[model samples]
Target chain A: MKAAWSAEWLKLRRSRVPWMTVLAISVGAAAGGLFMFISLHPGRAGDLGLLGAKAQLSTLEPSWPSFFGLLAQITAVGGVIIFGITVVWMFGREFADHTAKDLLALPTHRAAIVAAKFAAATVWCLLLAVYLTAAGLGIGLLLGIPGPLTVPVAAAGVGRIFVTAVLTIAITTLFGLAASVGRGYLPGVAVLFAVVFTAQIVAALGYGAWFPFSVPAMHAGLTGADGPSPVGYAAVGAMAFVAVTATIGWWQRADHTG
Target chain B: MAVVQVAGLVKHYGAVKAVDGASLTVAAGEIYALLGLNGAGKTTTIRTLLGMIRPTAGSVRLFGTPVTADARSLWGRVGYLVETPAAYPELTVTENLTLMARLKHLPAAAVGNVVEQLGLRPYAARRARELSLGNQQRLALAKALLGRPELLVLDEPANGLDPAGVTEIRQLLKTLAAQGTTILLSSHILAEVAKLATRIGIIHAGRMVTEIAAADLPHHVARALRVRCHDQDTAARILRQGGYQPLSNLDGMLSMTDERAVWHPDEVATLLVESGCPPVHLAVAEEDLETLFLRLTARGAGA
Candidate 1:
């Protein structure tokens, strides 16, 4: 298991996919900051160009608490797409690059390989979550927000943002399944887009609490005031369990034709 | 004892039977070559042997131990390169070998040693993405050769290599075999298989048509003596009178498959000369492996 993890880590470090994931999350963070800047002073929005005077910031609040909520929403919405791709690429490239066959029949078991990949994905997603919070806080400070980040307020806001990121990461495990069954990045990416779109529609229909993918964005208040119920968290746990089991089972049992 | 054993290995995908009751055994120190054409089930059989695919009904044992996907202990002594060689495109050659060494649980020194063994030192620091097809193949081979594994399973190990590279690889396999490492390789290139393998198994349409020692391959192929004389009719008559049945093909040359005639062609020449049909051209010819393979497959040996 250790060897497999190290091998997975080495490949992850050397590949451009990790860099791409970082870049995507960084852009999401910067975009979150941009939206906050625009909302704080809507009249000066013209200086920011196209999304300027025409865009409305009616429901948005120009305060630290609201900024953290915006960041959590970004992590929920953008985190799924970015982290989904990261996990998908981790598994999909083995097939795309035709390296999956080499991994089989090694001293290390296939289950260990699957576990190592999941571990790497988890680590990267957590790093992105940390970056999202840091970048959001930095941007809010730069904009000179009026609300004080009291200890209790900061803990509540950051904890909520972290949980949102975790939930988003949990559901993206399905992309790994898509990558394995579909055998490449394109199929997995297609699945990721489909899941994200369906989540939006499902959440809008007020069934977000029942759908795992919809719960993350809803928990982050992407669907307005209502947060996820305990049922939503249970659904997220079930999705994670199913995704990990299915991915590992596929790795062990499926014919690795590649 | 057989280092590798497979019996009645049948793998079916929906309506297509990719491998049907195929079986072979590679004893310790033997180089067994699974010879087949494209889509002839060579890769499928190799995959099953490596536990990449479960056989629909059959068994595979490596080193007298049953092989399963989770069987880790047996793999320590086994190294395999299936189908085309593959590596992490972003990692350098050395890094790739190092990773493989760790996966195989070999000493760290195995990395440099395998790189040197495969003549990959020049490209060690170069990323795999920059490598040519041939170098990528060498890197794959380097990964397989790490730790001087007791058994090597290679599929078209010579693919993408130049003539010199092929010879080098062939010599490397020979050296490994000489050191008592069992090798099971697959290739459609009969010449390479003939030169390297101690035994060859010909598979077609997902079944083993025949398995023969490499040295005995020529003997299994049909051999005959061809006689072209001033009067082909007279030569045929003389050969028939001499109790040897002669046959003619499109070229209108009388040929006899009589083992006696094939062994003692001088007797046939003398008989023809005595019958006043001095041969214009008389030569002993044997069917090549390609012709035998075509004949065997066409005959549906597996059917």
Candidate 2:
């Protein structure tokens, strides 16, 4: 397992996909800062043109809580696409590069390889989440939004954002499974888009709490703060477990013809 | 003990039977070459043996242990390069080899030794994607040789290699065999296989058509004596009178496969000369591997 982990880590670090994902999350954080900038000084709306005019309609208060909520919302939505790519690449690249066959007969267990892949994906996704949070903090401080920015509020806000990121990351285990079964990134990326679209429809129909994909978005206040119940979080956990188990099971048992 | 024992193995993917009732044993220290055309199930059989594909029937045993993905302990003794070799395109050659060495539980120094052994020291710092096809092949061979595995399963290890590289790998395989490392490989290069393998298995349409020792290949090849004489009719008559069955091919040359005729072609010439039909061309020809392979595979196909 250690060997597999080391190899997986080395592969992940050398890939450009991680850097691409980091760039994506940083861009999202920068956009979040721009929105805060517009909201903080709506008096200059006419001077800044259409974007500023649009920002004039902002309902979010110029406060730390709102800033954190905006960051969480970005992660919940954008993170799925970015982090989903990470998981997909982690599993899909083996097949795309024609390397899966070499892995199948290794002395190390297949489950260990699968576990190591997921471990690398999790760490990678978490790093992006951390980057988004840190960038959001930097942007907020630079904008100098009103409010004390109390430690308790900051901690709570960061905690909530991370929880949302973790939940979003958890659900992406299914994308790994999809990539393995479908034998490339296309299927996993297709699944990601389909799930994202369906989650929006389902959540808009008032079933966000029950839908695992929507639960994270709702809890992050993309929907209202009357967010997911404990049952929703449990459902997310259950779905994550099922996805992880099913992915490992597929790796262990499937005839790896690729 | 045999290094590999495959018994009545069958693998069917949907309606196609990729491998049907194939069986062979590769004893320790012997280079067993599986020869086949494309889609003849050679790759499928190798996959089944490595547990990369589950057999629909029969079983494979390596070193007397049944092969399964769970047979982790059994795998430590084996190294395999199936189909085309693959490596992380983004990683350097050294990094890729080091990763494999780690996976194989070999010392970190094994990477450097294999790189040197495969003549890849200059390319060690190059990314895998940047290497040419032949260099990629050498890198694959290098990975397989790491830790000096007790058994090597290579599929077309000579693919993409230039003549020199091919000779180098052939010698490498020979050295490994001499050191008691059992090798089971598949290649379409019959000439090379004839030179390297101790035994060869010809597979056709998912079945093992024949297994013959490399040393006995010449014996198995069909040999015939061709006689073209001044008077072919008289030569045939004299050959028939001499109790030798003579058959004429489309080229109008009288040919005889009878052991008596092939073993004593001088007797046929003497008989023909005495009967007023002196031979113009009389020579014995033995079948080469290509001819034998074609004949056997065509026969198998017809059957």
Candidate 3:
């Protein structure tokens, strides 16, 4: 297991997608900052109405720190996109380039490879999430917001973000495994999107966000005052169970031919 | 004891049987070559042996132990290079090796030795994508050799290699074999196989048709001697009367075969010279691997 983990870490280090994700998150955060500045100091509301209602109304009080918080939420979505690409490339590239044959040829168990990749993807997502959260807090504080940033609030925020990132990674890893085993690209992305979209709809209907798909969104939506509901925990648990089972099954049964 | 043993291995893709009841053994310190045409189940057999694919019916044992559900433990003693070298395009050549070494849990000092040995030091810092195809192959080779595995399974190790690269790989394989590393290599390149393999197994349409020793190949493979005589008509008549089967006329050279006895080129030359029929040169046309392989596979396909 240690060797597998080490191997997984090496794979992630060699991959470029993680750095690209970091760039995307940083860019999103910067754009959020710009939007906040423009909304607060708008020359004219009539001229800037085209941006969005959020931008127009964002001028009320217009605390730069709060704007950073909003950007953090939006950038969290970028984390998902990054997770998607990482998931796709990690599993898909093995089949795309036919390296799975070489990988499977290693004196490792079939299940270990799958588990290692999942662990790697989850850790990558978590790391990125923490970075984004810290970046948001730093930018918020730097921009001179009003409220004192308590350690508990920041810690709670980071914890939720971590959970959300893990859930997203788990869901996407299954998609990746499916894509790899199925030997295709678009199908995996489509399935992942479908699951996420369905979960969003279910959560919006005043239902519990405890479904496997809803965990990421729930994590993203929960702020300092909005702790996780009992249903959210159930949803995360169920999804995790499904993800582990599906990954193991797919790795064991799917063809590892290059 | 055999280092690796495969028994009645079978794998099917829908209606097509990829590896049909194939079995072979590799003793320690032996270089075994699995020779076959495309889709002849050579790759499938190798994959099954590595436990990359689950066989429909059969069992594989490595070093006297049945392959476990978690195969990672077995990987420590094994090195494998698939048909095409697979490396991380985003990583520099050295980074790729370093990562593999770390994964294999090798001593920190051994990494540099492998890099230098594979001639990858110059390209150490170049991203894998930046390297040429041949360089990528070199990196792959370096990765496989990182920990000096006890068993090495190479699939088409010389594919896409220039003559120099091919020679280098051949020399490397021979050196490893000399060092007592058990190697299972599969390739369509017969000459390379002939030069490196101590034992050869021919697979035709998902089944191993024959296993032969490299030294004993000429004796077991049936071929003919082409005898050129001073008079074609006299030679043809005499050969017919002597119960030899006439093959083809290569321009002016006449080909004949006598399967009843082992062909001695020197004896045939002496006999032809004495018969007043060998005024010109005489040569023995023993079956090369290409011909033998074609015959074995063609016969299997026909059946």
Candidate 4:
């Protein structure tokens, strides 16, 4: 398992996947700041030719708490897409590059290979989450919003953002399984997009609490004021279990003809 | 001792049988080639042998141990390259070999050794994506040869290589076999495998049609007696009345493969002459490998 992990780590580090994921989360952080800037000064919406964008900012507050909350919300949606692609590419490239065959007859077990990929992906996604928070902190300081960032408040806000990122990463495991079963990046990406699109519709229908994929976004308050119920967290837990087990089992037992 | 043992192997994708009842045994220190055409189950058989695919029936054992995904220790002495060569395009050649060496539990020096062995030192720092087709194949082979395993299973290892590269690989496999390494390779070229393999197995339409010793291949070659003469119809009938079964080639010339006709063409000439029909062309010829493959594979002719 250690050898397999080292191999996975080297491939992950040498590839463009980490850079791409970092860019995605960094951009999302900056975009959150821009949204806050527009929310704080509504008059600039029209004066800067931003049209009626101010109407959407009516519920937003130009405070540090709000900034952190906004960052958490973006992490929900952005983490799924970015982290999902990272995991997808990790498993799918073996098929896309036609390198899967070489790994099958190795001294290391197939389950060990799958676990190593999961480990590398987990490390990468967590690093991206850290970057998102740091970038958001820098953006918030630059905006100079007048509000409380008391130690407890800051801890709570940052904790919420990290929690959202962890939950989002959990769902991305399904993307890894999809890529392994479907045998390429496009299949897993298709599943990722489908889940992201359906999450909005499911959350809008008031059942986001039960839909695992929508649980993270709703817990981060993507759907207005309502946060996820306890059942939503259970759903996420169930999804992580199922996805991780299926992926490992698939790697161990599937006829990897490709 | 036999290094590989496959028996009654079968694999089916829905209604399509990919490999049905294919069986072969490769002994230690023997260079065995699985000779087959495209879609002849060469890749499927190789995958099953490597435990990359599960067989619907039959079993594969390597070095006296049954092949299974969980038999991790069994793979330490095995190295392989199945189907088309592949590598992490983003990683340099040196990096790729280093990673493989780690997975194989070999010392780091294995990387530099394979790079030098495969003549990849010049391109060590180049990413796999930057390599040409032939060089990519070299990298794959280098990975397979990294730990110097006791057995090597290479499926079409010579694909995309130049003639010189092909000769080089053939010699390398021969040298390895001479040093007690067992090799199971696949190729559709009879002439190519004949030059290297001590034994050959022919497969077609998902079945093993025949297995032959390389030295005895001369006897199994598709040899035929050909006769062309004036009044071709009369000459053919005369040969037929002489208890010889004849068939016409696409060129409208009569041909037969009976041992009597091929070994005693002078008897045919005398018969045609007595019938007052002079021969224009008469000779014994061997068919090309493609034709031989068809004859051996048709209806599992030699199975």
Index of the highest-DockQ prediction: 1
Number of the top TM-score candidate: 2
Q: What is the C-alpha lDDT profile of model 1 across B1-303, one tens digit per residue?
A: 999999999999999999999999999999999998888899999988888899999899999999888888888889989988899999999998988898888889999898989999899999999999999999989988889999999999999999999999999999999999999999997877999999999899999988889998888889889889878887787888889999986799988898999999999889888888899898999898788877767665536
Model 4 residue B46 distance off true place after TM-score fit, in angstroms: 0.9
TM-score (0 to 1) for chain B of model 4? 0.90
Query: What tens-digit string does per-residue lDDT give for candidate 3 at A88-172?
Result: 7667776776566655645545567777777787778777777777776676666555566677656665565566666666667
Q: What is every candidate's alpha-carbon RMSD to the true fold?
A: 1.6, 1.4, 3.8, 3.0
lDDT of each: 0.88, 0.90, 0.72, 0.89
**DockQ scores of the candidates:** 0.82, 0.81, 0.49, 0.76
DockQ of prediction 3:
0.49
Say which prediction, candidate 1 or candidate 2, comes out ahead on TM-score. 2
Q: Which candidate do you rate higher for DockQ, 1 or 3?
A: 1
Task: Pull out the clashing pairs in model 3.
Answer: A107-B71, A107-B72, A107-B75, A108-B71, A108-B72, A109-B71, A109-B72, A210-A235
For model 3, how does the per-residue alpha-carbon lDDT over B23-112 read when each residue is reduced to its tens digit? Answer: 999999999999999999988877777777788889888887776435667878888887788887777887777667766768767779
Q: Which ten residues in a row have the lowest lDDT in candidate 4 chain A?
A: A50-59
Q: What DockQ results for candidate 2? A: 0.81
TM-score of every candidate relative to the true structure: 0.97, 0.98, 0.85, 0.92
lDDT per residue (tens digit) for residues B207-262 in model 2: 99989899988888999999998778888888998999999989999999999999
lDDT of 4 by residue, A1-258 (tens): 999999999999999998888888878988888888887776775688764643566667888878888988988988999989999999999999998888888888888899899889989888888888889888888888777669987898899898998899999999999999999999999999999999989987889888899988887877877888888899898998899999999988999888
lDDT of 2 at B48: 85
Please list all clashing residue pairs in model 4, or write none if there are none: none
Task: Give one digit per residue, the lDDT tens place, for model 4 in B1-303.
Answer: 889999999999999999989999999999999998889999999999998889999999999999988888878999899888899999999999999998988999888888877889999999999999999999999999988899999989998899988888888889889999999999998888989999999998788888999999888887889999977898888889999998988998999999999999999889888889879999999887667767777758445
lDDT of 1 by residue, A188-216 (tens): 99999999889988887888888888999
Error of 3 at B17 (Å): 0.5
